[model samples]
Target: MKIYIITERARTITLEVADSTEIMHIKLQIMINEGTPIELQKIVFNEEELEENRTLKSYNIVNESTLYLFRLERQVGEADMTDERKVFETFENL
Candidate 1:
């Protein structure tokens, strides 16, 4: 079956997976393709959070089902620097 995945960045991709595929497996694929860590991935289907231990079939996910993917936001530490490139670009345009 093919599942539609929409990333938090609004990117869309289709994945071919089996009904027996676990939710964690899907996260693994996303990690490989989108560079998102599995621990940070949150997948929602039918307005419900999909469990990592459950399979697609357990969620009654069928072919052509769409799943939303979100990356868990992490708290920025004091050592983290904000990207100032956008501000620089705006000044350049001015």
Candidate 2:
């Protein structure tokens, strides 16, 4: 089960090795990559927020799932998001 991870803050990307479950693996991977512990981090997926205290295994995640990491891009504003979102939305509308 290859689980994907998105480092929202650092904009770093990596794959988290599957564990008996994705519990500790999630914590360890994020901690190692970002050098921050779960207790002091904010994790989100696909524009939805996630709790760090809980385990990922319980989230009903499946194999080969594509996860996204989002963060505030410095010197950028909501305009950037709206523009990109509009493009994607427009494409789908077409």
Candidate 3:
């Protein structure tokens, strides 16, 4: 089945999976493709968190199911870095 994954940054991505596939495997794929660490990834569907040991079938996940991906760690080079750069530039301009 094909599932839609929405990242913490609100980026949407598509993933092809099978009913027998485990949640951990999906996280592995996200780690490989999106560079998100498996330990930091939290996948949620229909307001419920998906367990790593469970299969897609266990969650009744069907084709086109939307999963929300959340990263527990702070993402580098994102808002934090940008804000720091802005502060540095402001100080430089003083």
TM-score of each: 0.78, 0.46, 0.75
Give all candidates' CA lDDT scores.
0.89, 0.58, 0.90
Estimate candidate 1's RMSD in Å.
Answer: 4.8
Measured by lDDT, the strongest candidate is 3
Writing each residue's lDDT as its tens digit, candidate 2 over 30-51 gives: 6777665555445565565665
Which lDDT tens digits does candidate 3 get at residues 2-93?
Answer: 99899978898899999899999999999998988788899999899999999999999999999999988656654466679998999999
Prediction 3 TM-score vs. true: 0.75
Comparing 1 and 3 on lDDT, the stronger one:
3
- Candidate 2: list runs displaced more than 4 Å: 19-24, 46-48, 52-54, 68-94
Which residue pairs collide, candidate 2?
none
Off by over 4 Å in 1: 75-94
List the candidate numbers ranked by TM-score, top first: 1, 3, 2
Off by over 4 Å in 3: 74-94
How big is the positional error of residue 2 in model 3, measured in Å on the Cα after superposition? Answer: 0.5
Best-performing candidate as measured by TM-score: 1
